[model samples]
Structures are given as C-alpha cells and as structure tokens.
Target: MSRVCELTGKGPITGNNVSHANNRTRRRFLPNLNDVTLMSETLGRTVKLRISAAALRTVDHRGGLDGFMAKARESELSARALKIKKEIEKSLTAA
Candidate 1:
C-alpha cells in the first residue's frame, strides 16, 4: 500500500532537499511502516494491517494490543479479520 501507517493514519510528507549550490529538490518523508498480523480477541481471528514502526512500538510498550485484540475477537463474532479481508478485496478490485 502507500507509505503510511494505517493504524495511526500517518503518511508521507513533502519537504525540500538542498544541494550545495542552494538548489532545492522535492523530497518525501515516509513513515517506517510494516505489514503485521495482529490477533483480534473480539473476533477470534487475526487482523492484518500496515502500521508504522512507531505505532507498533507503542502497542508493544502498552502490552495491551494482543489482549485488546483477543477481547475484541471474543466479543465480535463478525471479527476484524473479516473487515480486513473485505478491505483487501476492495483494493484488489480497484487495482
């Protein structure tokens, strides 16, 4: 997908790159994103998402991502995995 964090909604930023001659070129600052499968407790399934490294770190630091997902899966019969699956399908259709 795009160079964006789906969880945090972070995307590439525009900036300028300067040369020795003071000439400027367009530059893009992209977030560090990774495709990961997070367990969903509410749905008893896994949720795959493109998240930024920072977001992942935050989840890891909180020690609640997994637990929250599990709870979500258990609570939601139509789980987040299904949503992800649909979203992927929609993307595929557009492509």
Candidate 2:
C-alpha cells in the first residue's frame, strides 16, 4: 500500500538528517498513518480508511466522518473516500 493518508492527502516529505559533523543525508519524513474504521452517521455504516494522526484528530474535531467529509475537498480524497463522500452527500440530501 502507498504511504499516504486517505483522508487528508498527507504523504511523505523529503528532508535532511544532519550529523554533528555537519554531514547531511537525505531522508524521508512520512506522515504518522494508521488504519482506522470510522462510522458514518449519514450512511449508518462503518468505513475503514488509512489516515494520518492529524487527520484523525481533525475528524474528531469536525464531529465525525460525515461532518469531515462534508467539508473535505474532492481533490484531496482517494477513489474509495470520494465514493463514500458521494454516498454520504446523496443520503444527506435525500433525507
């Protein structure tokens, strides 16, 4: 699987590891990702996604999967997430 956050679109970032001797070596700073299953209130089901810690916290702050998805941008979402977002929107609007 790719090292990317499905919810927030956070990916690996390149940086340098500097030694005490002033030697710099290239390194990757990857986002702290986790596999989580979030429940969608609108869809009334659980959905699993690979998301970053920050994104997981944001999901809580935003009030859950449905709320976060409502404000989430289309470009940042993966194919699976985008499909879930669409389902949420359709259900919400139909309700």
The candidate that achieves the highest TM-score relative to the unseen native structure: 2
RMSD, one per candidate, in order = 9.9, 0.5
**lDDT (tens digit, per residue) of candidate 1 on 25-84:** 999998888989876443456667777788777667656454333333332223343455
lDDT of candidate 1 at residue 46, scale 0 to 100? 64
Each candidate's lDDT (Cα)?
Answer: 0.61, 0.96
**What's the residue-level lDDT of 58 in candidate 1?**
69
Q: Write the per-residue lDDT of candidate 2 for residues 1-95, one digit (tens) a residue.
A: 99999988999999999999999999999999999999998898999999999999999999999999999999999999999999999998899
- Each candidate structure's TM-score, on Cα atoms with residue i matched to residue i, is 0.61, 0.98
Error of 1 at 62 (Å): 2.0
